[model samples]
Target: PLAIQQTISVYLIAYAAMSIVHGPLSDAIGRRSVILGGMLVFTLASVGCALATDLPTLLAFRAVQGLSAGAGQIVGRAAIRDLFHGDDAQRLMSQVAMIFGIAPAIAPLVGGWILGWAEWPVIFWFLTAFSGLLLLATWSWFPETHPPDRRVPLAMRSLVRDYVAIFLNPRFQRLAAASSFNFAGMFLYIASAPVLVMQHLHLGERDFGWLFIPTIGGMVVGAYLSGRAAGRMSGDALTRIGFVVGGIGALIHVAYAALADPFAIPWAVLPLFLTGVGVALIFPILTLAILDMYPRQRGSASSLQAFTSLVVAALVSGAMSPWLSHSTLYLALGSASLTLLGWAFWRWERNVCQRLPACPQETTAVEPADPL
Candidate 1:
């Protein structure tokens, strides 16, 4: 599994570099074709993983899978936004996310079992088979969502314009940066967890599953509450609330490190639990707000989100986490710092957008995002 995380990081890097290409490519080639191509790549990568006997091979192929996975994620998000707009789009995307979320919840438990009962290669075989079935489903039933009439050329001139628009949109960049920081905190924890828990704490993989349960449980709570409170609270308000909560949780973790109690189970587990809840609230809201910013290029915007988040996470995992071992304070403070950055960005974005013209964020005093 540590190898898997490293491989996953490799995929993240590949996705960061390449996901934008697929979105526009889909615009030209058609959604169904693009989806099928991504699925095929994913399946082939799975097979490569299954056949991999060394870390390098697995990492390379996992990079391929990451690229494909990134495409699938961006394509799915764009396709939904294409099908609907505004609040309707948000609801639909959440439902799609719910479907995808189920797998991660199940995947950890299943992967733990595989790690327990079978060798690592078996895990790849499972992925290979699962991806193969998905490929079949895509080929059989998925119609082209991007009709010929809707096709937009993936020209370099347009791509540059598209990205420039995203970066230039101060609101989009802030939101992207906020979410990226949020993700960095989460991914930093994930990268560190295997070693921190398994190697240092001597917890078994199955125990790790139990630990994962709480974080997801928190997320479920946040999601449910956010949904119920949707009428009374703006998504930005929800994000603010999540930021406060996540920041507090991270601070607690950092505090434990400062006190030389980083090894205490409560210190590790509870903060992660809180972090999960905060992220659940933050994710749906942040994503909706950003996706709302770009009507024509939701795909590209999503690519940017995934790109920034994944690159930060991957770099932190590969370089930073490994460097902090044996220094509990560094590990905790380093992780907590990302949360602090995210919280600051969120507040700043809330303020700056207050000065915009025709601010759609008629939350009165609330800030609005820049153009698409």
Candidate 2:
């Protein structure tokens, strides 16, 4: 079990760590090429995993797959920013979120179905086929989102300078941190799923859907609402609404954790629905803000944004979740803390944007984001 856990963690670690590289690579080249290359590598790595005879070989292939898997998402995000802006971008992003939300809830079930008919290697075979399909689709249909004129040189010095400048910029850090902390709220539950399902809810292994289905359902709804509200609502308005809804959900979770006689389904899982909705609403807007900050280097910005969230999630999984998973109250506290802190960061950024001359003029010009 421990070995299996290590293998899983290693994949995630590689995914997060390699994100910084992929983002810049996309900027230097183009979104279509980078995405195709990543899919090709991932497909080959999946084939390698399927053929591997030893655990170490499997792990190596898994790492390669992980390193390549994130390219689509990160580059795809930059592509969205590349092609669209303002309400159009937000609407597209929300729709993307709506569709993407289904994958996590259904992927495990798909894996189970594959396993029932064949061995574990069959799962890798499926991934190989899937990525191969994606590679072909990208090659045939995906237009180059990043233009050659807009691309930055991939020189080592320029790469270091761009990263350093982005990281050092206070507004960029704040926006990225806001996104990271907001995501950590739901991630706490994800990382503590074992304790949450088996210990608190007394659910069997197969019953995990009880928690995920409702949460993802709410996310779909929220993403839908966000798409509808994109032009009508300011980015700040959406964020504030999200925090309020998320706070209410956290309070409900804490109340149940404290007041319920025995932890059970529906009640134990109800708060997650609202939290998921809140997260969905906030994600696209914050993501856009980060990307908008560095229009020319949107790929690098997307990479750093993802890296921030992934690193924080990895830490929560490694350190925070362990300490909080012992009790429902602790988990509630963890969730609430992330939400409140994320809100704080957003508030601080809002204030700084109002006061700072360096703040991007287009942020306010395009959307009139509330100072809150």
Candidate of highest TM-score? 2
* Superposition error at 40 for model 2 (Å): 1.0
Local error of candidate 1 at residue 349 (angstroms) = 1.3
**Deviating ranges (above 4 Å) for candidate 2:** 99-102, 112-118, 354-372
- The superposed Cα distance between candidate 2 and the true structure at residue 371, in angstroms, equals 39
> Per-residue alpha-carbon lDDT of model 1 for 13-34, expressed as tens digits?
7777887677767766777877
Model 2, 1-372: lDDT tens digits are 576677678788889988998888888788888898889999999999999999899899989988998898899999998999788999999877666555655565566567667888999999989889888888899899999977766766677667777787778778888878987888788778767888888876556677777778778888998999987888888888988888899899999998887988889988888988988898888888878777777888888888888899898889999898998988998899998889899889888774222356342211111121
Q: Where does the lowest 10-residue lDDT sum fall in candidate 2?
A: 363-372
